[model samples]
Target: MTERSRHLSVHVDRPVAEVYAFASDPANLPLWAPGLGGPLVHEDGAWSVLTPHGRARLEMTPLNEHGVLDHVVTTPSGERVHVPLRVVADGAGSEVVFTLRRAPGTSEEEFEQDAERVNADLALLKQVVEAGAAGGAGGPAGA
Candidate 1:
């Protein structure tokens, strides 16, 4: 059974490279995505975050010029959920797309709630990237 998926995107008034640079950094996730809990912790060369579901490990795709920001979140229960994201050029700005998938047994209400949370996170990402561009701050820790 294929899982239901939704492609949610936001347009940011920043260059694709700039947007990708910031969003691809795991260190910057907490700045825009609050659903991931607090700051990231790096241990034994792996990144982890304290989500409401407890400590979850994150496996991210390698940085590339194509603006792929795909990642996998390994839940405490050992469920690995793939998150597909991208930053594509939109004229002088960029479009950030996040594909949210409905896991098996997830209700319609739960899926909708997840989409809402992703939308909020994307909005915050736009705000942060635009603000940083204006203020000349590279990103989290000058990323």
Candidate 2:
């Protein structure tokens, strides 16, 4: 029942702030994330989604100058899992990293598959942010 972790990253050809502005919004998850994403519902100040497993809540970090996009997922059974995410500057572009931790009882195959899924999610995030930037969205010029 030991916990293990993996990290996946993607480089987005966009400014850090622009990437953070888009990726940090939980409501935009379904546009990028694959398995875990959904048409999220916001009620009572918390974002909830009807996950395949059950109803789950996404509690993201507060907006800040730092590019910390960390959040916690609370399962229907009250199990809380911490998802460590960050968007940081890389020259004029940015790099997004997602840390996926295998819960106490997850199998090895499941953990590996989870890492792959997270990688896909990060790639999707990069695509979404870059597409937004190319469309003259995300922020003002040089923002």
Candidate 3:
């Protein structure tokens, strides 16, 4: 089958729970997520996100068929993005595994660009969370 995937891993100098608490909450994307803006959320699982290039409305459907938490979001460009978030322990730090898969229609170049942008956001997430963990500047992304 044709597929696209992006794997991003980061070591946050914080407890796994702390890192997971911030990263897992999509609503806080605006505060820490780079190249994206606004996490306007709704009661029915719909969210509005503003990208550097444009805006997107994401509709999330949570599924519990397996032991993992799985969600699918519809991108602003009409592409469905599948995401799997996993948290692992690594001694004094924490490891985050992000698996992204999408179908084709857009060029690989475009995908690569998007990946870079998204990866930058992930890196910022680590920074923001770790920065907060040390009692330096970690506040609710929404707060």
Question: lDDT for model 2, on a 0 to 1 scale?
Answer: 0.80
CA RMSD (A), model 3:
6.0
lDDT of each: 0.85, 0.80, 0.60
Q: Which candidate comes out best when scored by lDDT?
A: 1
Could you tell me the lDDT of residue 125 within candidate 1? 95
For residues 33-140, could you state the per-residue lDDT of candidate 2 as single tens digits? 866857689999999888777889999988877788898989988988888888878888988888888888789999998888888888888888788733323422
Give lDDT: candidate 2, residue 48: 87
Q: TM per model?
A: 0.90, 0.88, 0.68
How would you order the candidates by TM-score, starting with the best? 1, 2, 3
Off by over 4 Å in 2: 133-143
Each prediction's RMSD to truth: 4.0, 2.9, 6.0
- Angstrom error at residue 101, model 2: 0.8
The deviation in Å at residue 81 for candidate 3 is 2.5
Tens-place lDDT digits, model 3, residues 19-78: 656655666666566465564555555676766546666544342222132355566677
Candidate 2 lDDT at 58 equals 91
lDDT-better candidate, 1 vs 2: 1
lDDT of 1 by residue, 53-138 (tens): 78999999987778889999999999888899998888788899999998889999999999999999999999999998323223
State, as a TM-score between 0 and 1, how close model 3 is to the true structure: 0.68
